[model samples]
Target: MHVLVLGAAAGGGFPQWNCNCPNCHRARRGSVHHWPRTQSSIALSADGKRWLLCNASPDIRAQLHANPALWPSELRGSGIHGVLLVDAQIDHVTGLLSLREGCPLDVWCTPNVHSDLTSGFPLFPMLDHWGGLRWQPIELSDERTVTEFAIPFLTDISLTAFALHSNAPPYSPRRGTPSCGDNLGLFIVNRQTGQSLCYAPGLGQPTPLAMRFLAAADVVMVDGTLWTDDEMQTLGVGSATGQQMGHLALDGPNGMMALLDPLPKRTRRIVTHINNTNPILDDQSQAASALKAARIDIAYDGMQLTL
Candidate 1:
């Protein structure tokens, strides 16, 4: 499997237009320690000929243009097979609108996420006139049973989605009361190699099931949205703590670092979906040094991994 990090920053991205935080400021001024990143998203391919986009970042247009591999071979076409969305965050789903350029879009998402977009956001409805949108609901089992699904048009790749602890989108009626399909922990496997990847880009608190998947996978690309629980509050950028925004901060005794400390060394760990406020964006910062000491890699745009 070929995994490409299309975009690696959190919503608003690094050097957010409206933000002048120290990190974003440095990034804007071309500091070598900081590099600009787009909103979070990735593209995967079992066979390099065709690709599956995991999440559609708001910057998908630029992301696609930046990568020649994703360019269309013919005069008017796309190499992208389809999209598999983990959730219905604005940064994740709004890119669908940008793709309504006379080409039908095939999308897969949890039914609850579909409902939120179809109702409150109405993005699916609004996109029907142009190019048309195909909705492939990711079936969830009752009693919280996790099921494996083989996405159509992709070979030797399968996905198993487990329930994750995270808040629903604000537009959703089930915002405060999360359901089975509210958020997901995706375990993507390469059937041929038996190597797996556990991806949880938005995790508030850890569950036994999530921990098990993380420990078992060959590579774990977990959330690194904030460095401390009170990062947002201390920075005076946002009133909510990292936990309040459905992110498990990497610091503290009960943080994600401690959770993965006991995992086997063979299980490569990487962090993605980083926020602009997170000091780890600065490679020379203490947070980045700590991440390196812990043997965890920080994701950046265009980073690629093969399994």
Candidate 2:
């Protein structure tokens, strides 16, 4: 299994155009210690030729440009074989609009996510505009369901979607609707290699089932939205704590640091969907050192790993 980190920063991305927070400030200045990243998204390939994108980030064009192997000149209008969405967030699904010009694509997502995509963005009308495009909705269940799927040019792969708790409050059906189910996570296994990847980007809190999946995986790319609960408040950036923002805080007792400490050393763990305010964005910062000591990688935009 070859995994490519398309865009590793959280929602607004590092050095978010309008923000002047410390981390963003340093990133704009091109400080060696501060690395710039794009919004969160990834691609997985069973063989190097064909790939399946995990999420279609708003930065899809640039991400594809950065990784030419995935979108060579001859494959430009052909499009990827499939796209799997992790949530209904704007950053994750908005990029689907860009795919309209390419070959009709296959989109695999939860029913909730599909609903969100279909109803939320009237401007895109992706589902209706692209005749060749298809939406394959995966109904998440408490018990895992395994199925075989193919990513063009790659080996057949096994996919599993499991129900997990949503950190966000329920969206009012009366007011408006949500595009994706509030609860979701994905476990993708490569049938040929027996290697697997567990991805949960908008993780609220770790549940027993989530932990079990994390424990069993060879590579775990979980959320790393904030370094501390009071991060935004302390920095005068926002009123909510990290938890209140719907992501796991990395510091303090029972935080990400504590929860991830017990995982077997062999398992490769990485933190993606990182926030702009997180000090770990500054490689020389203590937070970065702490995470490195724990063997947790802070994701970067062009990072790639072969399992």
Candidate 3:
């Protein structure tokens, strides 16, 4: 399986337009240590030809422009077979609009997220006027059971969805009840090679349920939204901690780093959906070094891995 890091920054991206925080400022001033990143999203391919998008981030157009593999052919066909949404956040779903240039699209998500998109945000009605859009509901089950779904032309791949703690989107009518399928995580397994991967860019917690899923995969990419719980407040970016914003911090005794430390050494662990205010973006920072020593990776746009 081939995985592409289309974009690595959270909602607003690195050096967010309205943000003048230290990190964003450094990136704007072209500081070598502070490179810019687009909002979070990833692309996965089983045969290296047809691909499935993890999330259609707002930066999808730019991200696609930078990736030649995702470019359309002369016959006007896109390599993207479908999109799997983990949630219905604006940053995650807005890019679907950009894809409405006449091609049919298949979108897979949980029922609540599907409802939020069709009703709360009403994306389906608008996009339908442009082209065909199929909304498929993914079934969630226990970590031990692999919920199955098939990607067109990738018969050798099996896709599954797992329940995650959903803080729900701010616009969601169904808030607080994670069991409503407001959020989810995906596990992609190669039926041919037996290699598998897990992706959860919208995690609220690395619960035991999440851990069980991670344990079964060879690669796990999860939320890396903040460095510490109070990072946004200290940086004057926002009043909410990472947890409050439906993310897990990278540091602290109860943080994702410590929680993920016990995973098998062979399991490749990486972090994504990072906020612009996090200091870990700086390669020279102690936080980055600590993560490296702990065998964890900080994702960057355009990075790729073969699992």
Candidate 4:
């Protein structure tokens, strides 16, 4: 299986249009320490010819254009064969609008996430007007037995999805009422090579269940949303902490770094879905340097992994 980092930044993406955060400022001025990224999303391909997009970020159009591997091969055909969604957040789901053209896409997500999109956001219903949006519902595991799924075209790739602790979308009826399928993390395995990968862009905590999934993967790509829990508050960006927003901060004793530092040395750890306010965007910052010292990578657009 092949994994491609189509976008690495969190919601508003690096160098968000309106804000003048230090990181964004430096990027706007062409700082070498910075490389602008699209919103979070990735594409997985077993054959390198057809891909299964993870999330449809608002920036999917530009992201696809930037990666030649995803470019269309025929007059009206595209390399993307299907889509898999991990949650119902705006940054992750809105790109379906841009993708409504051409053939209908086979979209996979938990039933609750599908409900949120169909009722709360109504993106699913809107897309249906043009026809061809196939909903593939998935379920969380009871833990006694593992649950897994596969994209027919990507036959060699199998994915095991486990519940992740995250808040439901504000517009969702289940908001503030945690449920099993609100969010999820995927453990992708290459059946042919026995290589595995874990992808979770939103993680509120390092729950035992999450750690189990992480322990089994050769590569771990997860949230790097905030430098500190208080980043947004201190930057005057917002009052909500990373925890409140269902993201794991990168600092603090209980932060992401602490959560991942003890993983097996051979695992390839990567940071993605990073908030623009995070100082790690500056390669020279202590935050970025810390990641470097640990041999953890900061994901960038177009980064690829062949498993």
- Sorted by lDDT (best first), the order is 4, 1, 3, 2
Worst lDDT 10-window in candidate 1: 138-147
Model 4 per-residue lDDT tens digits across residues 27-49: 99999998998899999998888
Which candidate wins on lDDT? 4
TM-score for every candidate vs. truth? Answer: 0.97, 0.90, 0.96, 0.98
Candidate 1 Cα lDDT to native: 0.87
- How far is 144's C-alpha from truth in model 4 (Å)? 1.2
Candidate 2's residue-wise lDDT over 1-307, tens digit each? 7889999998888889888998898889988888899999998887676788888888888888889767764734533667888766777877787777764678877666655555654423544666545777776645354444444455767766765555422332412322236546777777777888888877767877778778888888888999998988998988987765567888888788888888888888899999999999999899999999999988899998886
Choose 2 or 3, whichever is better by lDDT: 3
Instruction: List ranges where model 3 is wrong by over 4 Å.
Output: 143-145
Better of 1 and 2 by lDDT: 1
Superposed by TM-score, candidate 1 places the C-alpha of residue 67 at a distance from the truth, in angstroms, of 1.0
- Judge candidate 3 at residue 213 and give its lDDT: 78
Report the Cα lDDT for candidate 2: 0.76
Q: Per-residue alpha-carbon lDDT of model 1 for 1-307, expressed as tens digits?
A: 9998999999999989999889999999999999999999998888775888888889999999988888889897676888888888898888888778834888988898889889999988998888677888887533367688987766888888877888888788987787878888789999999999998898778888888888889999989999998987888898988877788999889887887788899999999999999999999999999999999999999999898
Q: Rank the models by TM-score, top first.
A: 4, 1, 3, 2
